[model samples]
Target: MSIVVNLQSKAKPETTTKLISFIEEKLPAVRGFSGCMQVSICLNRDSGDLLFYEKWSSKEAHEKYLLNIQNNGVMAQLMSYLSDPPTVNYYESLDI
Candidate 1:
């Protein structure tokens, strides 16, 4: 089943611009990874928070890629740039 991951983080207000810029700059590499169906970054309509919406071929595929050496290394670097821990939720398409 196709998997969707929704992630959000609390960031320093000034950092929002930088954060979005960083995500935009780095997303191509992520989307190019194996099994990545689609990826999008958007500002939360209500909270003005950063949101990452990603679709993968499967939950297993997403986990596998996250554990892979290359992506894991990149993830480590990305984590360091955040001001607070991020929240991640996984879901599968039910009707659409």
Candidate 2:
């Protein structure tokens, strides 16, 4: 089964609009990345909470993707719109 990755961050209020535009522009490359099944962004308007919902072929694939972004400065660019460092959690489906 694919792994689900949830990445959450609080956007700086002033930059929230720009952040959404940035994510929209960047989503295509992410979706085309190897092992990425799907990815989407969700935002809470009132609280400025941003969520990155992703599915990948496996944990290793997602890790590889992270390393790619980190080394390429994409991660740094993305972080600049946020109020603080983001939190990430990976999930596996239950047999039920």
Candidate 3:
């Protein structure tokens, strides 16, 4: 089953511009990753918070991507742009 991930983070007001640029640079890599169905970035204009919505082929696929990111230090580099820790949640699509 496909999975959806929501990642939320707050950027320091002063770092918002840098944060957006950094994410934009990295998005293509994310979109090209194996098992990545789609990905999007959203900004809360008033709060300057960032929301990442991602769809993956499966939980295992997402976990593999996470491992790859950790191994390549991509996660650490991304976290450096945030003022606070990111909040991540996963959901399985409901067939209803």
TM-score, candidate number 1: 0.76
lDDT of each: 0.75, 0.91, 0.88
Best by lDDT: 2
Model 3 lDDT per residue over 14-81, tens place? 87888888888888988999999999899886887889999999988888998999999989888887
Q: In model 3, how large is the Cα lDDT of residue 22?
A: 85
Off by over 4 Å in 3: none
Superposed model 1: Cα runs more than 4 Å off: 44-48, 69-72
Pairs with backbone N, CA or C atoms under 3 Å apart (clashes), candidate 3: none
- Residues 1-68 of candidate 1 have per-residue lDDT tens digits of 78898888765565666767777788887799788999987775346566789999888877777787
lDDT for position 83 in model 2: 96
lDDT of 3 at 56: 96
User: Which regions in candidate 2 have their CA more than 4 angstroms from the true location?
Assistant: none
Candidate 3, position 60, lDDT: 86
**Error in Å for residue 10 of model 3:** 0.7
Pairs clashing within candidate 2? none
lDDT of 2 by residue, 1-96 (tens): 888999999999999889989888888989999999999889998999989999999999999999999999989999999997999999994557
